[model samples]
Target: MKEFLSFIKKEFRHIFRDRRTILIVLVMPIVQIILFGFAVSTEVHDARVDVVGDLADPSVRQTVARIDQNPYLHVTAVLGSVAEVAERFRAGKSDVAVCFERNFDERLRHYDKAFIRILGDGSDPNTAQMIVNYVNGVLSTVQSELSASEGTQTASFPHVQYMYNPAVRSSYNFVPGVMGLILMLVCSMMTAISIVREKESGTLELLLVSPIRPVGVIVSKAIPYLALSLINLVTILLLARFVLGVPLRGSLFLLAVMSVLFILASLGIGLLISVVSATQKTALLISGMGLTMPTMIFSGIIFPCESMPVILQYVSDIIPAKWYIIMVKKIMIEGVGFSYIYPEFIILLVMTLFLLVVSVRLFKRRL
Candidate 1:
């Protein structure tokens, strides 16, 4: 009991001595949650739209006002002709174009027929669809008003078809990406730091001086972490399946196999980090900033890769997490098989082999 108490006191000293680890442990999760929740959004907002055609009609002007007043959309350009709207859209000045037909008021009152074309720039299909929906809703309200004034009952409403996010619930897409990020974070970053922590405290030397081969030592370090990470993977899968209602459309066996392969890759990276880092603080710092942060940003874990700058997009190709995220997304959401995701799988395998080979070579050099 006395020895246990003394050991506990020594552990306390080790923890308190490293202010960096303490701060990271306390602040990292809070920062991640806040950053992910408030800043990362799948919903489009303040999308710019161009209103074209007859500005003289009061109904048309009202429609424009309604669109402009919407917080999600802004009528930034008012053009005279459809050609101008198309030109602006091609120039990337507008996400959507709202065109009011000629003789709009006369057509609505006399014929019970009105036409408006919502031309979209199809570059970002999701935002284009949303803007089109807003335009359609506005047109419906105006049509209803005209029918009410005429004492006529209307039957038909405008049709809206989403292009990219057809289902419109982004959680379907986000869950798999979230799983990839969690795996990378828990498996790669945590294992790296944990193993490096053992090294920093001199226990690694004692273990190495024993009968344990380097490979055995590495495997032993990874085994418990791999188990813990698999448990975490199961929890995340359950949350995604039951809690979030994301269907596992593809083979569960394939996802599990890929997950295990990914775990091995992650363990390789963690072991490499352990071998490189002389101290626990350095390992945590390198893993947190070098591995985790870039994975979060570049893996399409939160922000859409299509939305990122071209340079950043190119840089993202190198991140192993990006490939894993793509693999998971293809498997879970698109219901794709190994044949489709094989290229990315190959890339991941290649990266894992490369990291492991380099780490082994470096370990030999250090010895």
Candidate 2:
């Protein structure tokens, strides 16, 4: 019995001596719980909206004020012309636009048929629908106030028109999300495991000493996964279009370009993980537990990030999948081109560069 106890103590000491294993075993669960618990939500908050109408009119002004005051919506811009509403959406400045016809107060008072137009960007059909519902609720409250003042029930409310996805298809939302998830799985998980397998077999040292530059070696290793991810992208698009009946309204060329960029970023993450992991099993565990779950939870793939607790929402900004999903939705469903998605593109580029730099430095230290 004493001999067995001594063996157990030695085993535990050996396991605890490896810092990478200790970090993975002890730290990963707590981090994942905090991230998944706090950063995931289904409700919307602070959704960006633009108002276009005569600001001088008392009713129009009141309605805009009410919308601005609502916690769920933020009135970010006031446009001078109704024509600018589309421009606002195309520029990605707003998620929804409220346009009031000229002399809206007078029309409501006399004709009892004033028209308030609610235009929503339906790239995220669910969010677009929710925004419209919130807008309608605000309009209803304003109409009630007007009716109470006039001592009549003759106030007309706004009519909503959803652009890009009038039908509010769920597939439109899921396609981009699925695309992001699959690419993350392929580029991050697969690449990390592959590289760590080489390390486990003791061949990584040989390759490191070879003629190829370290950066070149890493890039070459990633090329196959990059190509595989692109193939998966096309396959998912085809399935989304034909099987799920989701529309690909944007430029396919632009989608392909952005997808490649996202794949590169994912590869960078995998390479960094491989640099830190001592074994292929450790690499797989870290990639799955740390990368995969967070990508699904915090990326706004299944839940709206705005609804998450404020701190978690801030944490989600670091997730590459979040930006990639947003870019894909904008390009595929909103039909916006590179100009509208440049900010996300730049962010992804920065993240990719950071990951690659860290991975390269760490890998050199390992040598």
Candidate 3:
């Protein structure tokens, strides 16, 4: 008991003296949290739409207004002719175009069923399908409003055509999500083991004998791992870009910034693990059981959260990796901005602070 007390006291002394390690411990987790929170997400929103119709026609103008008002749709350009619409869709400047035949109101009055033709660029099937869904929803809403006064009448739909990804590739959803899971495992567990290895080897004591502090030793260990993690991040991103061919619709700068946050968050967790376990093997086992298993089950990477048993869904709330996976999927796949991701960010921040506080309290108790 006396020896354990003495060793813990020595650990505190080392921690206070090593300013570099302390800084890294404090800073690294935030970087990791930001990365996981902002760089990833699964859902897509605010897709660009093109409207090709006579702005002067009242019925066409009203339809355009409805499209513009929708939160999921953003009108990037308006076309005057079929030639212009075809050119934009073929150039990939637009995902879907709304074209109204000449004298749209006149035709509706005479035929009681004029169609607003929708043409979609089907280069990416999922995106093309999403575009059709959006247009269908818009047309439904417009017809629903028009039908309220007619008692009970079936409304005809404006024709919607899908261009590409007639079958949305399952790979489009799986590939990016897999990258998030892989990084979380490799970066966090690897760092945790490295720290615990120092404890298992006698060098941790030698470092204590030096002027360096416990925190400094931990930080130095973390720094090299963080670098390696970043290299892995770059490699994974490039593979997703060049090899898998995922589009980077969002800003790369923002992605880099968020990645660093998640890395730091993971490092803090690794340090906390080191402080708990006396042996490297114990640390590895605990880290795996604590982080990896739960993360895989709850992170919604493999299984959808909605489909999970109610209890399991609630259990997922505590898993940090679950939140990270959600955030990454939204940012990378959906191309949403920070405002859309703030709730996930706040949750991750809370988890990080909770972990830090717990580790600090534990360190003090052992001391």
Candidate 4:
């Protein structure tokens, strides 16, 4: 019993003394708790809604006011035509577009019913569904108020239309998320492990001493993984298109370019991890556990960034996967052109450059 107690104490000391062990065992849990506590939510909040057409009508104004007042919905725009609304949706500005009939109040007063269209961004099926349901609730509230005040029931029923994905397939949202997660993990994990394995085996030190420059060494290490990730990208695209039946709505060439940029960015992350990690186990832990949780949570894979708190939303911006996922959704599902996606493309480009510069600078010739 005394010997066993001594062994246990030694084990405890080993765990606490090793900074990597302490970080993985103690700090990761706290980060995950903070992310999940603030980031995860099934309910949509502050959904951006655009009210199009007859905003001058009293009843229409009342309905729009009620929609803005709803905790889950915020009326962001009052537009003249659905053509403008379509532009907004394609630009990824509006979530739900509520189109009221021309001279809506007149139609309501005279005909006892009027047409209203609820347009939602179907790239995100869950939020689209929730926004439509909430819009319906608000419309229903308006009808009840009308009946109570005028002693006559209104027969207006709001028509719902989902853009990009009329069927509102859950796969549309999930496929892009899966793509981001896979590329991020595989590129980062493989690159980090490959470099760290060389480091552990003493080969990296030998290579560092060779006539080849450090940049050459880094490029050689990255080239194989980059090619593999490209092949992996193609495989995922084919599977997503043919096997899963997800539509490829935009230019394939553009998608390929964007995907390559994302892969490079992920590879940069792996390089960054390799610089800080001394061994294979440490590299694996940092790349796998550290990258995976943040990519999944902050990348808005399973949750909407707009629904999270302001600070979390800002944090989501730093995750490369978030921007990639957004670009993928717009290109693959929404069919938006380059003008709509350039911002995300630029962001990934900047991140790749930044990570590579920092990684190379931190990388030393000395082991």
For model 4, which pairs clash?
Answer: none
lDDT of all predictions: 0.72, 0.78, 0.67, 0.79
Worst 10 residues of 4 by lDDT: 29-38
List the candidate 4 regions with Cα displacement exceeding 4 Å: 1-153
Query: How close to the true structure is residue 56 of candidate 1, measured as C-alpha lDDT?
Result: 79
Candidate 1 lDDT tens digits, 239-305: 6677656678788888988888787788778777877788878887888888878887898876788
**Deviation in Å, model 4, residue 249 alpha carbon:** 0.5
Q: How many residue pairs clash in each candidate?
A: 0, 0, 34, 0
Taking the tens digit of each residue's C-alpha lDDT, what string does model 4 give over 1-367? 4533453454346445767644544444334333333344345778899999777789899999999999879999999888897789889988999999988888778888788999988888877988889888888888788768878766655555789877555567777877787778767876787678778989888878876667766776676556656766776677678866789999898888888899889888998999999999999899878998988888877778999999999989999999999999999998889999999989889998899888888777777
TM-scores of the candidates in the order shown: 0.65, 0.59, 0.54, 0.61
lDDT of 2 by residue, 157-223 (tens): 5555668877555556666876787788778876787678778888778877765566665766676
lDDT for model 4: 0.79
Measured by TM-score, the strongest candidate is: 1
lDDT of 4 at 149: 85
TM-score of 3: 0.54
Q: Model 4 Cα RMSD, Å? A: 14.5
The best candidate by lDDT is 4
Better of 1 and 4 by lDDT: 4
